[model samples]
Target: MQYKSQAVAKPYFIAAIGLFVGQILFGLILGAQYVLGDFLFPAIPFNVARMVHTNLLIVWLLFGFMGGAYFMIPEEAETELFSPKLALLMFWIFLVAGAATIVGYLAVPYATLAELTGNDLLETMGREFLEQPLPTKIGIVVVALVFLFNITMTVLKGKKTAIATVLLIGLWGLAVFFLFSFYNPVNVVLDKFFWWWTVHLWVEGVWELILGSFLAFVLIKTTGVDREVIEKWLYVIVTLTLITGLIGMGHHYFWIGTPEYWQWWGSIFSALEPIPFFAMTVFAFNMVNRRRREHPNRAAVLWALGVGVMAFLGAGVWGFLHTLAPVNYYTHGSQITAAHGHMSFYGAYAMLVMMMISYAMPILNGKAANSNKSQVVEMWAFWLMTIAMVFITLFLTAAGILQVWLQRVSDSPLPFMVVQEKIAIFYWAREISGVFFLIGLILYITSFFIGGDKKETA
Candidate 1:
């Protein structure tokens, strides 16, 4: 809203939410496939639905991070965007590529899609999360390079605030780490081992940098906090982030054919991974408590705080639940991993983007905040979605524990399908919670259309 170029972010935000809705829908499908076993049957198998669900989540969050960057980078740098035109162009290219890729996944067999997209030449198919064909992976790299250029040049042209700098590091690191996905060695064990280089380093390392920068930007705006103070905190926090998280990559090594020492390294370091997030919570609320201005966007403030608390609970507490090697020996690959992925991504990445959208969208719409009624509705959506996710996590955790007890720890382990049958009741409960999540999605989408009198600006 501070500059004309910021308007480009609106489309990105819209697309993110649209794809988010799609993700939740696919998620519901996967939840059904878990219990029903034939809900979609030949049309959409569990794996296909899962791929769609995860791909949509990734694409939408990328949309959000891009949107958040496009919206905030210019304002933070105190300049017009370097090239709004290029930014807009990249938007379409990325969107089209993402949507087409998804269609390819659903329309034809994955094998055919891989063959059609030239995967045989590179053999990047069949890997978890990196299952995108060669061309799609290359396209992603291209988009990332262009994006980094756009943002980096813009920062050099104007102010280089700490928030912007941290975000730039994050974005750059994201591009660098993703390249490891292409390091598909003939050795399957090595391939999966380094795959964590892309996955774990992302969520635990670079992505946290992005999350921190976004959280700092919003706190600075809403809390009327000094940039110097916030920026200094950004430095210390991200430093510790790297210190703890880079080593935390060892956690994933437990499953792969890595050395035995990783058990100790991963367990010790990864346990410390929660500190920065907890610091983030303190940082957000502290800034708000000392606010010099009472921002009219009470809903935005709510979101800021929610990200903090939820990130700590989801990423910090839940992650530490089974992070150790001994505990993971029993619980690895259970629904517990599912539980962790859902909350951590939502709290850390997904909600961070939505929080930025919440803050910036109101300003973009020519108001300090939405109508009080609109904010109330948005908050309602927040609680509904968040609380439902909590239930989902709890139910999955319960199922995972039972699974470990019945299958892994017991003297006579049940077969996989048999154990699944035993846990069908929890799946039913999870499906019910997912319904509430969908209802929240509906309410969240509906909130944007609810118009009310704008808050008075002095």
Candidate 2:
């Protein structure tokens, strides 16, 4: 709200929350399907619902990153956005395209969607997370370019802070890495190898840069920490992130028909991958402990702290659990991967985005911070969602261990479907936990509309 143009971020943030709601609903559907296979068998199959769930997650987080940049950059630069109109235009364009593409996935069969969207020419449809049709993929590149242009030009015309510079580099890397998704060679090995260049590199690589930058920006505002100190921590975090994560890509190569060397290389590097998250946890708590003054936004401060703890436990701890080659050989593609995917993404990216919303939404909505009641509710939502995710990961991890034991490790190995039958109890438990997650999401969306007394920070 420092500049009128900053208001543009409002819609982007709102859209992100809306999509997050959609993502959770589909997630519940997926969970139910895990236990009750025929719940929506043909009408909305597991794969369809899953695509909707995951694609929404990616799209919404992208919205969060973009909105965060739009809001923070102008303030850091000490000027308005360079092209507010372009930013707005890109918002609607990206939103509409994303919505249409998701609807296309759910409305029609995926193969039909691909055929209609001209994936026959590019053949980028069958990949794991890059399942967006060719047209959608092209649109993604276009939108990213425009977004980079607007933010880059604004930063150039205004101030150039370390945080802003690092953010731009991360965004640029995101766009560049995504290009690898288009390189769908015939060899399945090559396909998966390069695909991780986008998937792993984004989450584990450049996205960490964005995460650190945002964390620094929020800590500076809330903790009254010296800018120099926070930015220095930011740089250190990103450096460790790349040093560990870039090489951590080898872990994926272990099972992908790659050389045996990856097993050693991946195990060694990925084991150290949690260092940055641990550092992040320390950095966050240290900043709060040394705060010069308390900001009025106690809920925002709470979120900042929660991001540190949860990101470490979910991404760092859980990741290290199965990251070793020996354990992963049995656990790969099991419920363990699913567990890691759920918590790690939620802990690192999803919660980070929500933290930004919790911090910025009140200011954007014309209050220094939310009413104590509203903040209290928001905090409740945070705990509910976060705790629910933890149980879900726990349940999935249980299912995965049982599965690996029964099907892979045990002498009397059972068939995959037979093992699944044994694990039905865990699936049921996961479905039950997912219900709470959905409820938490509902509360999260509802907290925004509540009104109460606005109090200033210390």
Candidate 2 per-residue lDDT, tens place, 386-434, comes to 9999999999999999999999999999999999989999999998899
Work out the TM-score per prediction: 0.98, 0.98
Worst 10-residue lDDT window, candidate 1: 449-458
- Model 1 Cα displacement at 154 (Å)? 0.5
Off by over 4 Å in 1: 452-458
lDDT by candidate, in order shown? 0.89, 0.90
- Residue-pair clashes per candidate, as listed? 0, 1
User: What is the overall TM-score of model 1 with all chains considered together?
Assistant: 0.98
Off by over 4 Å in 2: 452-458
Give model 1 RMSD, 1 decimal: 2.3
The deviation in Å at residue 185 for candidate 1 is: 0.5
Local lDDT at 359 for model 2: 81
Cα displacement (Å) at residue 423, model 1 = 1.1
